[model samples]
Target: MIHVVFEKANVEALRKSFELDPSMDGEIAEVQDDFAVGPLADVDTEEGAAARLQWWKDILAGGHNEGLADDGHVDDQKVVRELKAKLDENPEEIVWIWAAQNKHDVSGYYWLMSQLTEYQGRIYILYLNNLPFINEKGNIFYPTNLFQIQPKEFVKAKKLARVITPSEFEVDPDEWTKLCNEDKGVRQLEGGKKLVSRGYDYYDNELLKFVTKEWQKGNKLLQQYFSKSKEITGDSYLLWRLKYLVEVGKIEMQGDWRNMKDFQVRLPGTNAEAAETTSAEASQS
Candidate 1:
C-alpha cells in the first residue's frame, strides 16, 4: 500500500500513525509543494510552468519562500514524474490519497487525480472534510485537514476509503481544466463538486492585527509568533504577507527573511524614524 498526503505535517503524522498501528504496513509520501496556496496556471507546457515558477519567485523576493527555488527543491515536474513512476511501478498496490475539504487539500487532490487519470492501478480516497470526530473531551469536531486528525482516527478513515470510478476521472479532469485556466479560485465542495469563483484571503486582516498586538511584547521571531497564531493557514502564506508588511513599513525585519528564526518583526513607526527609513529602502530596492 502507498499513502499520499498533501503536506509534510500530514505525511509525518500518517507515518507515525502507521508505525504505531501494528496492523498497518505501507509507505507514505507528501506533495511537498502546497498547490492550493500558490499561482494556479496551466502547468502542462514549459511556458506556463515558467510563468508559474516566476509568480512564486516574485511573491518571495523579500524572503525565502518554500518551493520557490529554481534548483528543484520544490520542483513540480520532478514530483509529478516521481508520482507517475511510482504508480507505474506498483500496478497492483492500493494507492490511498488522504485529503480534506479545505481549498489546499481539495486543489491538491484535484491536481493529483488529474495526474493519475491514465493510471491503471487501484486508487482509493479518504476525504474527511465533513466527517465528525470525537475529541479527547468527547466533543465532536470536523477537522479541515489530516494534520488535525488523531492518529487512532486514521485507521477508522481507512475503512471509509472509496474507490475512484472511471466516470469520476473523466468529470474531475474537466473541472481541473476550468480551475487551472480560469481566474476563479479552486474549491471542492461536499459531494465532490468543484466550484471555481473569486476568492478572498480570509486570514490577512486577522493576522495583521495579531502581528500588531504581539509586537507590543517586543521583537518577535517570525516562525514562533506565527505558530502561535491560529487564524493563519500556513507558513508560506503568512510569510508572504509578512514580506508585504516589511515593504509597506508595517513590520521591520533584517537578515534573510527565509530563516524565520533569524528574522525579527516589530510594529512600524515605534522606533524613531525607522519606518520611514525602511520604506525608503523598500522603494529603492
Candidate 2:
C-alpha cells in the first residue's frame, strides 16, 4: 500500500505513525503543490502547466521566495505517474489518500482523483473532516490538517479509510473541470468535499485591516496578521500581496524590498521619519 498525503509535515507524521504500528507500514508519497490558489486553467496540459508556473514566478519575482527552487508541479505529475505504475505492477496494492478538511488538501484530492479514475476501487480516502482526535495533551480537538493530528491518533485514522466510490469518480472530476474552466484565483472549502471560488483579491481587504498608519516591519506585520485573521495562507503568498499593495499605492514601503525583515510597511500619507522616530523611542521605553 502507498500512503499519499498533501503536506510536507504530514509525511513525517505519517512515517512516525508507521513506526508505531508495523501493520500500517507503506510507502509515503507527497503531492507538493497548493492547488487552492493560482490558475487552474488547462493545468493537465503542458502549456497550461507552464502558464501556472510562470504565474508563481511572477508572484515570487520580487518577494521573499524570489530565488526558491520550484519544480513542484512537474514533481507532482511524476509522483502520480509512479503511483499508477506501482498499482499496475501489483493488482493487490492500494492507495490511501489522507486529507484533512481544508481547501489545500481537498483541492489536491480533486486534482489527484481525476487522474486515477481507472483504478477507482484500488483508491481509498481517509478524509479527516469534522472528526475528533486526541492531542498530545490528552485533549479532544478537531484538526483541519493531517499534520496537526498526533502520530498515535493516526493509528485510529487508518480505520476511516474507505474505497473511493464510483459516484465520486464521476462527479468529482466534473468539479475539477468546472474549477479549471472558471479559472478563479482562490478556492475555499464550504463544507465536506464542496469548494467555492473567489477572486485573486479575496484576502486583500483582510490584509489591509492589519495595516496601521505607523510603520511596521514586514515580517512583524505578517505575524500579527496570521495571529489575528481567521483565514491563513502561506507567508510567501501574503508577502507577495503586501508588495502588490505597495505597488498600487495602497500602502507605503521603506527600506529594502528583497526580504521581509529588511522592509517596513505603513498606510500611505504617513510621515516616514516620524514613524521611525516613534518606533525607536517606543523600543527604548
**Per-candidate TM vs. native?**
0.73, 0.93
Query: In order, what is each prediction's RMSD in angstroms?
Result: 6.6, 4.6
lDDT for position 126 in model 1: 85
For model 1, the stretches where C-alpha displacement exceeds 4 angstroms are 19-23, 64-68, 136-139, 184-203, 211-231, 245-285
Encode model 1's per-residue lDDT on 1-285: one tens digit a residue: 778888878887787677667565687767765565555667667887787677667666655554465667776577677767877887776678888777677777777788788773477888885789766677889887788877778877778788888998988878877777774332334344455544434445655665542233222543445567654455656677777777877767655666666565667656457768899999999
lDDT (0-100) at residue 231 of candidate 2?
Answer: 82
Off by over 4 Å in 2: 69-74, 271-285
Clashing residue pairs, backbone N/CA/C < 3 A, model 2:
none
Among all candidates shown, the one with the greatest lDDT: 2
The pairs that clash in candidate 1 are: none
**What is the C-alpha lDDT profile of model 2 across 113-139, one tens digit per residue?**
999999989999999999999998999
lDDT of 2 at 275: 82
Error (Å) of candidate 2 at residue 200 is 0.4
